[model samples]
Target: MDLLGGAALALGTVVVVVVGGGIVALVVVARRVRSGAIPRFGGTGIHELTRRAGTLLVRLDDRLRDADSELGYAIAQFGADAAKPWADALSGARAKVAEAYRLRHALDDAEPDSDRRQREWTLQIIALCEQAERQLDEQDDAFTRLRGREVSAEGTLRELRSRIEDARARAAASRELLSDAAARFAPAALAAVADHPAQADRLLDDAAVRADAAAAGIAPSGVSSVSGILAEAEQIVHRAGDLLESVERTVRDLEAASAALATRRRELAEDATQARAEVESAPDPDSGAAILDALRELEAITPLSPADPVRELDRLDEAASRLDLALAGSRNQKQRFAHALAAYEGTLVSARSQIAVVRDLVAGGRAGVSARTRLAEAERQLAIAEAETDPVEKLDAVRRAVTHARDADALARYDLGG
Candidate 1:
């Protein structure tokens, strides 16, 4: 009986120690959570922070876009020098927003392993958002002060009417422009800007309706309401103007592409001659064939053909780049470097043109995720190319930018059913 009692007592003691240790661990975990050293997955603190951060991030991004449009108007109303302060404000806000996006992207790309790190990142995002909001608010306040809050409804209404009238005139011209472009280029080539004039007309009609409503005193809050309605109408008119401008820009781009094709044809002939000599010495059949293929492609393109000079330029550039890479294997480093240095500027120009076209298309609402992603990457690569010191690296970056830009254009066109 004595031995049995001793054994039972020892077992009880062991159970108590195990339960006590568990209790101590729970207390420590609870304290750490309260102190924010540990995150509560189910807790409202981090969740609410994340939600608020996301909302503010989106809001700030939208405000930045609106500010960009407003800046253009500001420049129109007040000269560029006078609009400098607003421009500076926009620049500052953009910087903050960019950093915030980087943080958000990092968070999304791969979350931190620790809950504490997650909370910290969330807090940082929230802080950045708040900072951007404050920056924009200050700029808005300055703008309000500049306008003196004394913009009479009559004055605003007149301005809106004048802008709408100007838009209508431009819209007429844009239709003519589109007609000319359509006659010259393929429907797919002009697809990005084909309906811009009609779309602008519809937007102008909506702005006119809003203007009429403002004149009828149908707004909610007297003068403020009238001002608000006029502001919205003005924005719509500006949007219409932007659409018309896009048509003009597209025509300009097409003309530029045609001119570039003429220049590239001459250059291609020169490149083929040089490539043939190099291959004869180095015996690179593949490189020689690439140049020949590019030449054939260019030769096939006559002025009378349904010429897509932009696409042709891309193909020719790609082929030339392939030959360059192939030849680089045989050349000394110094020769390759010298060649890259000379070619980088022209390559950069082509890449920029390609990126700009697709960027405008994406902004016009024809972008899918894949298109947007490629466009962003292209832009990123272009920046890198511009900043890079090594000629070879810069040229490579430009090539990558061009490739990504082309992919973005294809995807956007597919999305647009063009």
Candidate 2:
């Protein structure tokens, strides 16, 4: 054969083998599909899942129905309003269970073209089943809680009654205590209770009414009302006790303050007398005039009856302190004046000696006219210092004399070239 015929033959052989293999594969696939040996894409598995989910949903529905019946019975035994939430939960669960059943049926009947859609339906059914199961569990939990409340209802009522009775006893005791206190103390002292006695009595009465209402099985609100009323009663009793204590404390404080005022008044009188003596005995009575006037004013003060005596006492204390300060200042001023006088005398003597020295320098012609003028000025200052009566002015004159005299003596020596 030629090269082209050989190549054509090889190509035809390859084509035949490929076609034959394809036909065999098709046949095997067809057989498997017909015989149910091969699993359909998302078909068998999804169907099994749907069946299982449907079974679980049916079982859950049955349980929910039973639970609903029980809840209904409980409502009947108790009140319809009491178990309303539980009934609503059970109804919701039943509705979801029904939806789960419908989705499961759709999953089972879906066509091959709708395999993905059927899987989605299967998933939805599972979710609905789980949601329904959760709802059923909620119902169960609610029912359990309701039963527990029912079991404890009698005990709660008994406890409420006991609390109300205790509150009543306490209120009675408080009222008795208030009455006794009112009798023991003056009416004015118990003015707080007197002002609001009606309100306090009303609190107790309201508590009694609430307690009666609770005992009559009105509602839980009745119990809450009782608690509020009892709280008000307690507050009233506490206020009354506080008022009594305040009145008693006020009385005691007034007594103590009155006694202190009397003692302070006596002390103030004695302080005024002593301040007068100090003013008279002061070294410089003229300087103590302000203090004596203050003492007189303190002695003249008289507090009106029922007026605050502390103000009067404050005035007296201020006056006494002023007298003490004034006395001390007067003594200090006297001592200062004496010392100034001594210093001024010493300065005058020194000035005179310097003037004499300057005069001798001028007489010897060693000092010039300037020294004579300074010496004359020094003598004039020294005369002024001696003639001055005010100690402070005298000291000023003496200081001036000393300065002028020293200057004159220096000029005289400088003229002598010594």
| Tens-place lDDT digits, model 1, residues 302-389 | 5545666666666666666766766665567887777676566556656776787787788878579999999999999999999999
Top of the candidates by TM-score: 1
Model 2 residue 171 CA deviation in Å: 3.6
TM-score per model over all chains: 0.59, 0.35
Which RMSD values do the candidates have, in order? Answer: 19.5, 38.1
Off by over 4 Å in 2: 1-52, 113-115, 172-418
In model 1, where do residues sit more than 4 Å from their true spots? 1-151, 218-224, 283-304, 329-349
Q: Write the per-residue lDDT of candidate 2 for residues 1-418, one digit (tens) a residue.
A: 5322443454456445545564454345446545655334344487686676678877886786567457657655456555556666665666556555555554456445365555555555666677778876876787676556544554554655565455455545555665665554444333333423344445545545654554454345331212323334445445444433333443343334345556656655665565566676666757568768777666676764433332333344345445445555545676446545644544454455445545545755667888888888888988888899988678677667766776887788788785
